[model samples]
Target: MTTPAAPARRVPEAVHRRRWVILGVLMLSLLIVVLDNSILNVAIKTISTPAPTGLGATQSELEWAINSYTLVFAGLLFTAGLLGDRLGRKKVLIGGLAVFGIGSALAAFSGSPAELIGFRAVMGLGAAFVMPATLAVLMNVFERDEQPKAIGIWTGGVGLAIAIGPITGGVLLDHFWWGSVFLVNVPIVLFAVALMLWLVPDSRDPKPGRIDPLGVVLSVTGLVLLVYGIIKGGRLADFTDATVLSTVGAGLAVLAVFVVVEKRSDHPSIDVTYFRSKVFSAAIAAVALVFFALMGVTFFAVFYIQSVRGYSPLDTGLLLLPLAATQMIFAPRARLLVDRFGHRATTTGGLVMLAATLAAFALLDADTPIWFLEVVFFLMGTGMAHVMTPVSVVIMQALPREKAGSASALSNTFRQVGGALGIAVLGSVLSAAYRTDIEDELGLLPPGARHAAGESIEATLAAADRLGARGEALVGEAGDAFLHAMHVTALWGAGVAVAGAIVTALFLPGRTPASEGGDRNQELAPAAER
Candidate 1:
């Protein structure tokens, strides 16, 4: 009699060993992309430590360093995916690695904020090409049947990159300069270029139609204005400020026009009607909400670590280990969970977990021990890992095989939108909280101390350290208030997560996982299908 154990054992035995090698190549390539994200956060203070080009850079420049890459990559994703289909995935992927390498080189030696932002934008452009290509190439290489396992591994790699980046960045910055963060990417990209050249096959959409240039213009402009207003909201007095409102309005209008252009294009950058498909739309929506909450936690948590909690760069990164680790550990399990629970249920549950995790984060305080935060961070990461990988699967499975690139691009675009809005919405909440509290305290102080009070949490802390007087401890009081405001912001983040959970739960179907052994849907979300 054949037992279940034999089938399980035979399945592993039949698996092509060479696929793991290809996976190794894919993982390294992807690691360079995601690692660039968290590593920069670690390098922020270190990079601006001494002020290389002139004197210390303005706070806006600091914001640009991170946002420049995020905005460009998000904006250009659709075009990059289309270009890959036109040019060939492997060729574009290889070229992107080279371009990314060059951008990293430039970033490593950038003398000014302008140079840094420009190079980072170049990096973003490279990343846009790389992101879609990685999944598409993997989709092409793995047969219809073997995709879920491969994707799970691939998603795990993303989680690993995320988890390890801060620690790696911290270690690098300790031994080398902040430039080391960018410098690190050079070797990795070089390695990826070589590995991809040797291992990956050249593939693209076979009968691709026209390329949409106008759509590209509109999407880029829209994302830039949207993200700019978001990141810069704190420096401004009003959200309704004419420039901010106008920029956001133009962005939306351009994107609206772009949508019309694509729907009519012989070769549309994206299939606008994909929203009509339940799986595709639901998958993207879930990711959008999930990442929205994640950004709120990650972005401001970093601020909390360095400014309010007073952790050093290395310490802050180490503190984030739980966050990354949670994502990594759960990514592989996400596939099995989804396999059993079905897509809608799995994703919705993930959303609930994410919301709960963020709600837990709201309980953290200046006096909260790091150990407690570590556990909470781990839970947050686990929930997020599940939410991301699974939803990605649903989107991929719902689309035509030839349309994976464009489908992936749109899914990612939603993620960027969610992240940008999270930053804007949650960040604005924090700013208002911070400004109001500080202003209230400053009103009691003499005019001389008001400027110091109006400064950021970091500046206030620096001032408090230098002041050393009991009566004139304006900076100290401001620092406390800063921590308080950040705490309130965490509550706002939790609220966003709750909203996301409800939306996901409401729309996502509660079906039992279908036993489509070699289903294309499973292949769609590379990480989630695992």
Candidate 2:
């Protein structure tokens, strides 16, 4: 007779009792990672200014500062998750927090744009380990029935970071130099580390797979090459450049090889077979596409509010309050909608709402009422809350409890990769469009400066400033160019969101019978496994 299978492990009662507190600690850890990005958004203009006030970095350099963090975070997340599963999550969490704190300190004192970008990558390495570990530990501590509720609350923490990051950065900018925004993270990291050591318990997979070093190398290499090419294309505003084509083509080729290698590996970092389920694949795709649309739109929205409308950083942050408020209000409650309408209807509806909000950007101009933009932001946040909560539940619930680390890693990797691409692609679109519209007006500057001025609205404005009273006409022209570019990028974002809606409607499951109840694990299992 075959040997009996081992019984499932149970969560300790003491651990169960303090699960909420553990979640609170995990959120605290998550806050600093996300907070850094949001704070950077509000400070981008200051960072683009000349020395003393800012770094004097160009728009392309600024995009690299953001994408460097995201690309590293995206590329290493799967491997980091596997490490957490093999070792202990608490150990990894502490280690990651320490690294992030060190990176933040180094980044705060960076003397140049290149140094800042390099330091941001170090922070990304730490964030890769922290993000998946939080969700994985939560999965282990909570019962399956409670996982959805726990994940919803976890998703809401992202909104909390979004709420706090910009306003905090604005306040810091008002009083201190731009570096203060990064410096603020050090104290929060220290506090979070203390709380994690005290409250969060260690957890890991009982039978972890071997480390796939080759797979890790291939994935990171491919992603960096791919993102570098995309960013380069954006900087040149020419996707057809010989260098762009070669790098993008090579990146795609390597990633294809990675897929083939993983398919044949006995102990892959990511189990490629799990994606056989249509529902699982669709859910992950939805996460990626929605972020792709939203992140791209947000990249331009900051400039539109600050540079075009002439709002101070603090005012811009306050204006964004509606976005964060609606997310916090609706994120946890999204589960109610999922229970009533099912993931298919809920996610599809949310994407539709998101698409509408993105398209509404076309209606905005320098003179539009501020309240009108706030309403759009509010609705956009509501839609995002619904989509994120339900899809996170779907992705996390699809895997076995033992594979929670991998599950969380896969979900987050796609989200980060999507966001990174969005910023690169849409930022390029905005750049190209702005250049096309403003090139004629740039004739007032020297030929050497005209190309640089045409690169971005900020660059244009800086060039115009040096011209004194003679540059007043160029300022009005720059605003018009940026608004036109924003309109074009918004429509592109809306189109991508609509594509996500269609994918969800076609592949995500409809309502299940009441008899099935909370047994979503079995329901979402791959057909091959069944």
Candidate 3:
């Protein structure tokens, strides 16, 4: 041999012992990001109440508040991942935490809806950096054999956030101002910052490459425009609207341009060819579809429990706890199932379970029993746990550790886009059905009240409350209308989940012991070595 290749260095014993502690810090970061979104969702009603204390935002403005965060977060994710890879993961993580805390502080004191929306976008920027860094750090810290267990634990923390966020927001709203939801992130961010500094190590790409500024511009513009179009279309229920069509068309065009550009670049921002791997493509699709169905169901479920069933926010949160509980319980166990039965079986089985749950939910009416709701909620959680956890593990295995930041950001981007589309499409379906049902019933109300009643369930209930006996009658009619809408939405979600199940079955590669690291290692080596 011309020269002997050096043996790979062993990880220090100290690092092995501290890796679990490092994971705790990473999860803390993940939890804050997850909780920020969930808490904002639960706090929307309080924040949008009539002025003096609340901001008095319109329906469109409220949607903007949520969508602004999601759009900005999604758009910046790829750039954020690249930054973390080039500049040191721990450094980016800390900077993100600081920026996030500042955004939260500003958001808490915002005097108007516009101010809050802008600040939320700032938080999104910070979240973009944090999300990728956490997963990248995990990858660098853990060896391949240990990744499944670590990922299981990481996903469990995400499940716990889902369980806690609504309840926490509900409790805060019951006793405090709506701004308390934003303020809560401050302390958590501080704690995570401190812990990460002490426990986590800095890591970066071995061979840093030039940043592709044009790629960043193209990706961000494409995502923001696409999401904006979807949100506007869903709210209006008019896909043919000139503004929506133009915006979405432009977004698609830019994304196509981005694909061509990435193909030609020597060091592309994202390697589009990664989709060539069956496992990689399947995991991304599974995540997107699963989230699409899940988000649609949850969006309506909150309204069903609170408006139709007449539960308090706290009570509603408690009612939804079963969903989170089952997810948490089964997430870790999903890895065990993967070890025993293989990823294909577990993933498809989970999808089938979710489809069945959605189908059963489609049959429920306003008078459906609470016990039935609880059972299905738990079952939905179980199905999601099985599907999401294994899919995440497979995604991690499909990509090389060196590309972890980009891969993680790519996975998260699909999830956000899927969730946004789900809310838009399913919401449009629900809105169309509800408006049709309510239109016939609204003729009995005062002309002024009729328009308000037709707008939304909340507005309908408020209008009814003002009308006394007429209001009571209207409430019953509105509840029935909402139930009908819920049924239609559930059916659509069921169909999506079934389609996802079939796709999962067809696209997800069969597992064999030799296939896990072998192919990915061979494919990733050239770039990784550079």
Candidate 4:
């Protein structure tokens, strides 16, 4: 007689207990991803020296090298989350690290601009896989009470990457070739892959569902076009006159279709119902805006300090230390503040400080002191600390346990998307404004002199001939013009933050944790009674 086979054994308790050990492994690996981004910022000077391409490669291409990885990352992450849920997060997570390491190796060996750009896109695909699985696994390993602290510890990697990228890049460039930056990821990924196999308990969702592949296609395409349109992409990437308008319109239509499809699907990947939570919605909006403004500063600050203020890469890194150094305290500690003060009060207060900082920055000049800039930005980072954890806790607490993976995926999606678009939007805005200001300032001189002054920013900056007399006067006017444009961007950023504050105040429930916990416990009572 055939006997029924024993049920498959689950992971042993010892194996399960070893799970948190993977966090340290993953942090070092993920830091490579984050560090690759800002690391290049400081090394811009060094990289340009050895390029085979003509000097001052088009602005769009420069933007691409930095943004391509993030765009792919933001674009593919939702799909990646679904993949993890359906197949297995552990499998995807390790695979992602492998892919990312390969891309980094390619980037390090890149011989031309095209090769570098291609490698960056490959890295993005790898990142697409890495991010979602990391969080989902962390949530899996820790209990609800313990999860936030785990996430906080995990987020500390971001702080470490941000503070250290420039410093590390500066030091590396001082010693080795620019490629050394990309090569650094190799060892970290190797170590993490080994640790992951040993310490991470591989698990998948016990209950699985269909993932809408068509919906994912539509969503990713739509985001690409939306990002392209906002950035005003050059025709070189196939953004021809016809393609630009048509691609943009098609993108919007596809996104609308995605929403409709998701609403109709029996097993939709994105939880359309989550929009009902005002707290979740408001907190997400805040995350997007804050990252947008923060990236704006980071994207251009290195260029401005080096190009205008004549700072070295090391000096630029040193200047940013304040933002990163003070922020580590804010990342985890801010949760306690959020618990004490309402999300509405802390969020509002934080945004106000961000607004004030940006507005104050509108007054900077060619002769403006670095110490002043440093002081203002230090306050900016300090205040932002108050906003981050509170918004995060609100979102996490509201999510049903079953849907937490999807929910956090969506929140992080907005953060990365906002960051990518912010670079494009803010950069384009500054370029247009700079051109206008230069033209008007040059109008004060003779027609011949006007053309010279109205030339591209490089031409004007390199024209040391303008340092005194008429040129000096024009420089002064140009500085004021730049400041004025920055003021408008700052105001836009502030307005978004203020809108978030209002939304939070309106939608958030006022119950204390004790009451909320009691309510949750009550909900569980009915099932137990059954």
Candidate 5:
């Protein structure tokens, strides 16, 4: 008569209380990191305009201001996770906050576009450190039963950040100089740093292995080159140009080699086998595409609301509230829909809604009712709520407990990569279409003015303002051309959403009642051992 095994003991009550407090701090840190990713959106116009009011930056330079941060953040995420594992996560987190604060302060005082871009990259470095450390610390503190709930809260913070960032930035831009956008981060960073030091516990892998130096080099180099090539191809170079072709080809080749190298490494930074699971692959793809659609729409829509519709920065941010508000409201409830309809149904349905919304946006013009855009924005945000949160839960379930930090970083990296690509490809299409439509209208202007106007919508608007009554007529023409370009770009975004929907439906595994419990392990296992 063998006795039944004793039930596992629960974490101590004191530890449990501490863990919840720590989680709150983690959420605060995550909120700041995620908010910085998008806070620049509503301020783009102010930052790039001619001096006295702005830096007088070029269009490509403006793109770099945003892309440089995302690119570096995405590129270093995995490597930074490994470093956090090897070093103390709390140490890394505190250090990251300091770096971010310093970068923000420096950015506020930047005199040139180059200085701002460089400081932005520094902030990205700090973000890379902060992001993985927060998740890793959360995983360490929470019990298995608690982790999923914790992750839900953490994911909800991202939605909240998205909801708040633009409006906050818009308000600041209304009253303050463009540099105030970066400056706002300084105080928040200080608060997070203080709270984190007091409440967060230090954690790291006791048996952390050697850092994969080659993997670090390859991932950073490959992603930077690929993104640079795509942006250049869209804005500055033809697809067939030697610089574009060679850079893109080189990036692809290096990434392929990186995959091969990782597969063979005894202690790889990213385990290639994770992608073998359909849940992981499909979830990653769906989330990435969701971000792709979101960023692509924002890339053009912000300009439309500002330049064409003549809304102020504050009003443009308010116009976007429907999208952010719907997303924030729906995010916490996403899991219920997943359980009711299953992952495949919920995710695919959301993608279809996104596609439909994008298609509707393609029909919009300068005079389309504001109410119509509000409806579209709400639907788009709702669809994203379904796609992002559910897929994140699926991914969290798919990863082993020990790999939490790396897996979280991986998910965010793909999302950032997708966003960067969307901007590049869609921005390129908009540029090409706008150039064709605007050139005919610009024939009446002097060559210098024509060249400047052809470069960007902002430039065209500025040129129009200089020409008095003729400029007003030119503004009308420019708006028309911009609307046409926007329509075509919206169609392209719709196609991407459709593809995501089809992929989610066909490739993601169907959910069953038992399968959900069976998918996750009951105990932690080190990824290196696996």
Candidate 6:
């Protein structure tokens, strides 16, 4: 005879009552972090312009400004997640918000590109704590049955940030200095901190593991080295350079050592064994690959819309509305698709759709209709919404509720690292391609200026402006070269998305009776229990 059915999992009365409110607070926290990145997308062109009006940042320096934040954020996330689980999520969240606000202020007043990059790293440090803590807190407040829906709404917050950030940045850039985009975070942070203290409850792991300082150091060092190598390769347009090869090799070596150390440690920063579960591994991989493709494409798209197409910052922000709008519309409803079609089918379909849209970029030229881009952005958002929500549910639910911080950290770590690599690698590809096509035309410029002019479309235009009427042919050639580079980069992004679709289809779980009940806790369960 079977034993009596186990009692249903219990969520505390206070938590149950205020779960939605807590989610709202968490979303507010998430909004500021995500909003900063989206706003920066529209401002990339402006940041590259000459001084007084802009920073006159080179393409590589601009990449560093972006990558510096991403690298630090990705590297510190696992440690921050552990801290949230051990020290208390509410404390970590409040502290993170404060730090982020401070960083934003510092970033706003940065005097140069170098200062901006440093300040952005400070922002990333705070964000590392903020992102995982938000998800970990949500997992605690909501019960298993309601998690997917809660997570869907939570993911939709990203859509909302995407919607608001560019438009807000556009208005500020139109009326005020570039610093206004960053300064705007201060008031919002103040409001979120007050709401969080009043409405959110503190939570932590009942049995927390020791902090692995060595692992943290290794991870950060490796990522920084790796990303630096990639960016350097792009700057020189030569991956075969000794510096690039040596740094990249060393980074891989350090990361390999990190994995080995984590495997042997008693209180590891990351439980390497959790990756044995094919479903868990696949979901994490999918997150990484998708972000890699998307972030890289986005880095180029901003320049395309502004520099190549001659659109104002305000127009670029308005044009991007369809991407964010579609995500807001589809993200909350994505769980319905998962329920009907299961994770594998839904995610696979989404990846295919994403790949198709990336490939569609190859069809775009300087003269491509704006409406075509709107359609592509709409479909791209729809695809992203479907992929993100279902996989998030899978990854979060795979481990016990108490380990939510680790789970969330693992998911976000891969996503951020993927985006960082995408921007570096794909940005490099675009740079290399454009440099090759534009180098010949640079003969019109002075000897020293030719090298600078070939760096990017913006640089070429800046050089053209200095040359007056004689630069007209160079201007036309620069636009054509950039389009070719963009097309090449788009295809590379599409190929990466297709690889993600394959991994999702092959390894992510199909529909199962216990899918919503957290399924089998095969790999992540404690050793004693296992």
Residue range 148-193, candidate 2, lDDT tens digits: 8999999999999888888998999999999999999999999999
Ranking by TM-score: 2, 6, 5, 3, 1, 4
Using lDDT as the yardstick, the better of models 1 and 6 is 6
- Each candidate's number of clashing pairs is 6, 0, 0, 0, 0, 0
Pick the winner on TM-score between candidates 2 and 4. Answer: 2
Q: lDDT per model, in order? A: 0.72, 0.89, 0.79, 0.68, 0.80, 0.90
Positional deviation of residue 5's Cα in model 1 after best superposition, in angstroms: 22
**Each candidate's root-mean-square deviation in Å?**
4.5, 3.5, 3.8, 6.5, 2.8, 2.6
Per-residue lDDT tens digits for candidate 6, residues 269-369, read 78888887778888999999989998999999999999889998888888888888888889889988887878899999999999999999999999899
How far does residue 453 in candidate 1 sit from its true spot (Å)? 6.6
Query: What's the distance in Å from true for residue 40, model 4?
Result: 2.9
Question: What residue pairs are clashing in model 1?
Answer: 151-526, 335-530, 389-528, 392-525, 393-525, 397-521
Candidate 1: how large is its RMSD? 4.5
Q: Write the per-residue lDDT of candidate 3 for residues 238-281, one digit (tens) a residue.
A: 67899989989998899999889987988777677777666677
Q: Candidate 5 — which pairs collide?
A: none
Off by over 4 Å in 3: 1-10, 52-54, 444-453, 513-530
How do all models score by TM-score? Answer: 0.89, 0.97, 0.91, 0.84, 0.93, 0.96
Please estimate how well model 2 matches the true structure, expressed as its whole-model Cα lDDT.
0.89
lDDT of 4 by residue, 1-530 (tens): 99999554343556447656767766766687788886877866555443442223234455666677777787677777777776788788888889999999998878766777788889988887888777777766666666666666666667778789888887877677778888888888888888778777665666655677887777778877766665553222233457666767877888898899988888775666666555667777777777877776666566566656778777888888777666666777765665576567777777777767766666665678899989976887776776676666656556544444565667677778778777766655665555566675565456765544442344454343445565666555555555555655555555655665566667554435754754642343232223
